[model samples]
Target: MTGVVRLRAVDIEDLRVVSALLQDAIIPIADMAFLPDAQQFVMLASRFQWEGRAPEDGPTPDDGAEAATRINCAVHFSGVTAVRRRGVDLRQRGAFLSLLALEPSEGALLLRLSGGADIRLEGGAIECRLSDRGDPWPVPARPDHGLD
Candidate 1:
């Protein structure tokens, strides 16, 4: 298909799309130790928290509190674009995305680029390259205990 493919920064609204793509792209390879439901829940929680969504009360401890914290520190850029970079490994199952946040006179923006051909934990860091379309924005990092 031929069309306008513009590259810009990321934003808050893009979180859902990025999260869904990451989850859909990763599930096939995630370790069988985790039930499908658990995997989906984790993915949704991560995406929702990142997108500033209120947490739902669950049987787990402090779930609501943690979700609130994540929502508070969330950040995003304005423009966004994506392209297939390389082949992904489907053997490993985990969601990994590189996000960049920026702020300009217009508004805040967030960019989320998905990697891994299938489902695998690929080591990478968030890259921020200033573009004419957006300015860099800082997102406060929230404290995560690595627990549910």
Candidate 2:
């Protein structure tokens, strides 16, 4: 996790790398903000926070200190040329992110939320910073073992 996990889509495989790099990122709609004039969208994400959480699944009794410390990061997409969506109402702030997809053809990205909301950005550069004011995220290696 030293160098940036940056991937520019010169081919389809590059997009797959970006997809794998963003595995299991949870985004609360309440923390999302989009600036139309600047053509930028930002979202605060809790990485490794898998979907389908139950009330009892929160910080466990014997979990380590990091259990309570969610790794929140800022994800920014800039230079958006156009945007389109369906079943999305930005006013409501109680949804969770289900997916983030990048289109190789148009260099755009799509954000799919839990409530069947799909926001499509036609053109932008995407990057995520692990800390509030730190540099871009470093590339992650795929784990060889499953959740133990």
Candidate 3:
């Protein structure tokens, strides 16, 4: 329970916060689900803990074997009428997607992923929550977007 985060988003401004928190999150293909009957969509993600650290204080393997942290998080979206995928293959087993951003689209919320994959969640309004699930774990490296 290292700095657990619980956030509820109902608008674009709040979603920006959630998006930043979820940036660089890794999600397994099998961990996502959409329940039409419940009008909800859910997914589990391994998110990098990006708070309380300076921009330059990133993991440096060659410096002194520095370690970073990652935590399991659960993301839930209610009032979801439909879920659509683009450039993603659901049949791929053991595949993972890196989340880049979550933004509001024309008639839905878009989850932009790495490798040009995206998920569109269409519904009446945005009602999303992100909660940390368990203890954080050490990871050797931080996610690099090659932005140097």
Candidate 4:
């Protein structure tokens, strides 16, 4: 059966889990794309504002400093909050997975196991799949720009 899941804001706690998941699911796929010293990867899943940053003023100097010190640019497997759906298997449960950051224009995003792993972006209507057979995750195509 089909279901709906919504992704909310992500926090430090969530980042912990996302980090592990990213290591498990993304590292082998990314291979040398990431640096060995890099502890995290920045991710832009949807539009979300930093707690202290205002819509008008942007991020503070402290934000930048903190991010830089903590390898903030990287996106880790933030965390998972589940919504059980009857008849769905253990691997197919609905979840609101967290990401580090995303452009404001992209709305909400959901992560679920559909065959392998899938990232479903709301407004963009984009679905990215990571092959279970150990293939790399498929990057979503960017929307048209100047041509449009």
- The candidate scoring highest on lDDT is 3
TM-score (all chains, Cα) for each model: 0.20, 0.54, 0.88, 0.17
**Per-residue accuracy of model 3 over 13-47 as CA lDDT, tens digit each:** 99999998899999999999999999999999999
lDDT of 4: 0.27
Q: Which run of 10 residues does model 1 get worst, by summed lDDT?
A: 69-78
Candidate 3 local Cα displacement, residue 82, angstroms? 0.8
Candidate 3 ranges beyond 4 A from true positions = 53-66
Cα lDDT, all candidates: 0.27, 0.53, 0.88, 0.27
lDDT of 2 by residue, 8-91 (tens): 443456556555545556677798777789877777776542221233646532232222222456666666667777786666
Best by TM-score: 3
lDDT (10s digit) by residue, model 4, range 1-148: 1112123235444423343223212211222121224322224232121221223344543223222111112233222122122222334334333332222223434433223444433332322221122112222332112344
- CA deviation > 4 Å runs, candidate 4: 1-72, 81-118, 121-144
User: What residue pairs are clashing in model 3?
Assistant: none
**Which run of 10 residues does model 3 get worst, by summed lDDT?**
57-66
Count clashing residue pairs per candidate: 17, 0, 0, 12
Per-residue lDDT of model 1, residues 1-148, tens digit only: 1111122223434434444322212122232221233221112112212323334665432343342222111122212222122353434456343322211222222223334222221112222221111222333444343556
In angstroms, the error of model 4 at 16 is 20
Q: Between the candidate structures 1 and 3, which one is better when assessed by TM-score?
A: 3
Candidate 1 differs from the real structure by a C-alpha RMSD in angstroms, to one decimal, of: 16.2
